[model samples]
Target: MGVKNNIIAAIDIGTTKIVAIMGEIDSDGRLRIIGMEKTVSRGVKRGVIHSIEDTIGAIREVVDRLQAKSNKNISKVYVGIAGQHIRSIKNRQFKYIQNGVGEISKLDVEEILNENFRIPIEVGEQILHVIPQDFVVDKEAGIRNPVGMAGRRLDGNFNIIIGRTASARNIEKCVKEVGLEIEELVLEPLASSLAVLSEEEKEAGVVLVDIGGGTTDITVYFDGILRHTAVIPFGGDIVTRDIKEGCSVLIKQAEALKIQFGEAVADLVDEEKVVTIPSVGGWDPKEISFKTLAQIIQCRMEEIIESVKFQIELTGLHDKIGAGIVLTGGGALLRNLDVLTQRKTGIDVRIGYPDSTSKIILDEALNQPIYATGIGLILNGLNKPIENEKDLGNDKDTGSKMNLFKRFFGAMFDTED
Candidate 1:
């Protein structure tokens, strides 16, 4: 077993499933997966926790399984968040140097970034992330790193992600109910991008589309900077609903049919072939044309592609997407989805599997697109510095109140013990 401090854990609570993973960094600075567990999610919908007790039970179950398998006590974890309420807005802020024509310092940059947190948001909403897109010193623009540069004024553009305040608090409540401390709450799209996108791809301009069970997450990167992020309310679950309604089958049967026989392009299906679907309530099996099933699936997929295209168009850099689109998440496994996406969007497409930058020899299952966010969470946790108690007080957009309770209750429990 590795040193306790060296171990990093992450929990990805999605609409369809909950995943808990534990990893440790090797001597070469590469991350290795020590243990992992996942189970169907019961209390979440579209990436948001709907029932706190149910969500807590799911998290506790997975965490216990992970701990038992790795023989390590899990105390802290990095978690991912997404939902229909998640949105991105662009804002700019600047700071005037106290002394004219002075070298830019870290404090100057921090001040500009901090200004974003003060920006007024809609009632009941809070900022989740403030990503600096580029810095401008005086008149010079497009400066990636402005430290040590002499400038009288520093200006910066940021992409701020915001979500409903209640949504975030619910997630914190669930984690804390399971007797765990949250290391940080990372946006699911950003975490997914970190796991699967290459620096070259980001530099050349690319769009990552993560189609999960309940929501579709979109992240656009250009010139090696995060440009935009969004979460559509619909995902693979909607497609399943369409199948169930269209074929008059059970929900589970619809999901199984979508995975086993669904195709994105109806024209590709041979009308001569048919599939027999077993009936519910001990009813006789029914025969359906394969083309009908493909048609139902194709209609829903095309709508999803159009939604993705609309998001890309909003960035105004759709034409500059040199690396095209990369799809990940559980929904990416739909057969021939890449081909359909390319046909609809007129751009190249590929299924995104998390790159092996971690250097961990993973099982074939972990290498799939569905695990990209989980793997990326570990990488993000290891690369990013841990937030101190003081920093938590300043991050109002997340669940800072919960952190306060954590500290107070933690101390109370310690005194009792």
Candidate 2:
């Protein structure tokens, strides 16, 4: 019971929302959400913090509310990270057998992977994830889980996700400043994929598009392997801003209208409908045609979806998405967004939510698409083999004691992560 009570928190710091969700690993190896809070984001845009002070204030507000909601202490967190600066690419690694051997061992596989991490990347880019795509032995090209097969050569194809070193550092600094330990940093889109994507979807191949407040993140998975990841710096904010300029209205007013009455397709609007706007000088309130407002929003959202389509084409993954696309994030909740995406990208689309896997039925508040990132982060750690793992014989003298002789001269605090 004491062990199951260890809380895991996921702080999803997005451009327009700051979320802190607390969950505990119950007896069934599932993350049970005990506390969840989201606050209006400040000094953050396009998933990057511009002012640490304002961001910290937002984080504190959410943390305070989450604590009060669950009466649980959440001091460590697995934060979700994303931004336009993140990038990824595919790489291959090959290792020749040392002795032209009879059998390949796990150590040999580890050495090959360790060398792959040494692949030359830009100085400011830090490797976040190295997902194995497949293994090639001799002439065979698609072999997954190639641990035990006699082969003189071991080769692997991987998709390496990297981000600007500064963004990575900033994520760590901000979370640590909030008196919380950084357990892990999961990319927002990648985390969302983990939360909403099913085994069938992954195996059948799918493209996940997360249209967030300030940016759209894309991830493509084929044959149960991540193939491409890209972060495009455009999202719902662009549409709102376009409305502000296109409709000649205040930003606040434009934002309100965009959410309340905005439509992604202009042709769908009824030409007779009109939305009234309160006049700026308290003069006569002007009534604007809903068709015009819808047009302005449609143009911007259309462009954004165009870019999404381009990404799919760029990856050469347009025809590979057998499961089509999974749309999640604040932007995905936009009316007819899924339909627009399907039309523009020529792929079937659906709004994704963690509710599909969640068992709680709580009046659609926590069920919103906004909770995807936080829930995904929690789901990531929950999938790990933590529970149902009994200790092996003489556990104390096993994994940890292998390097004891080398640790005798150094303090325990000096051990590295």
Candidate 3:
């Protein structure tokens, strides 16, 4: 059994579901999943908490189940946050090195990084994460690490993520009400990338599109640095809504049809195939053609892909994305989504799963895309450096993972019967 102190826990408070997961970083340093619990979310919409009471109730339910499954009390947990109001902007700042002509110390780097928190923003909004994109030492550009480098001044380019203060406060209040403390509020897109993206893909330039129930979170990485992040107000829920209205079916039925029969490309669906939808209030059962359902799904999914394309273009890295697009999240499970995304974007595409790489030990039940954010939260928390405790920026720590990568080829797994 692993030490209790090494048990890392995280909660993914998503729009459609709330997931509580606990893992332990073993002596070998590989992360092993011990338990996970998920339940339907009733208070969050589009990644924002709308009703404190409902969200609090849902959080307690999942947390209680998780504690029982693991037989450990969880106090502090890392949480993931995203929504329509979340946005990111690029900024650059420069500061002179202390005692010119001397080596730049870690203090010099932290000085400029902390200055980002002072950047101007609209009322009622605050910066959430400041990811250092690159560093320029003595006017030399594209330096990732400037420590121990001789320089007169330091210039840091950063991607600053901002969100509504009210949203974050609500999330904190809900978690606190449920007897839990938040370790940090991680951006959902950033966390998702950690789970699905490979070091090679990030270096070669890749775009991650995480289509959650209420919003689609997109993050663009180039030259192994985070370049841009955005959240589209539309996501899987919108597609379900479209199906509900177009096919004249209930929301639950629409969602079920989408999971069981929805297709991203209409041409691939059989025109003659039809599924009977259960009727309500003694009405006759309604039969909808598969092609019609697919057509509705395809139209909406095309919009999403176009939005994703537009976002990639905004980053000015559309042509430089060597690894292309990696789609994940619950919506990515739709039939033939990868094919549609590739054809529409005119770039190679692949569905990203939690086990797409050999980094984390896989729990067969958590291999699905829906659990990416929850799992990534644990990894992100474990990867955070203690030195970052004083730094105001987020996602800047990228050191070796507790010397765990050496066992990548031979992952350690422990599952209960």
lDDT of each: 0.83, 0.75, 0.83
Answer with 1 or 2, whichever has the higher lDDT.
Answer: 1
Most lDDT-accurate candidate? 3
Q: Report model 1's TM-score to 2 decimal places.
A: 0.91
lDDT of model 2 at residue 58? 87
Residue-level lDDT for 177 in candidate 1: 91
Q: What's the candidate order when arranged by decreasing TM-score?
A: 3, 1, 2
What TM-score against the true fold does each predicted structure earn?
Answer: 0.91, 0.88, 0.91
Model 2 earns a TM-score of 0.88
RMSD in Å for all candidates: 6.9, 6.8, 6.1
Winner on TM-score (1 vs 2)? 1
Give the per-residue lDDT digits (tens) of candidate 2, residues 1-417: 122455667899998889988777766555677788888898788998888888888888888888888877777677888999888888888887664555555555555555556788998888776666777876677987555567888897877778888887887887878887776677788778867777678778898888888999988888776778888898888888888888788888888998898888778889999889987876567777888988887777888888878888888878889999998888887777777777888899988877666522233567667788888887665533233354222343321221221111122113332
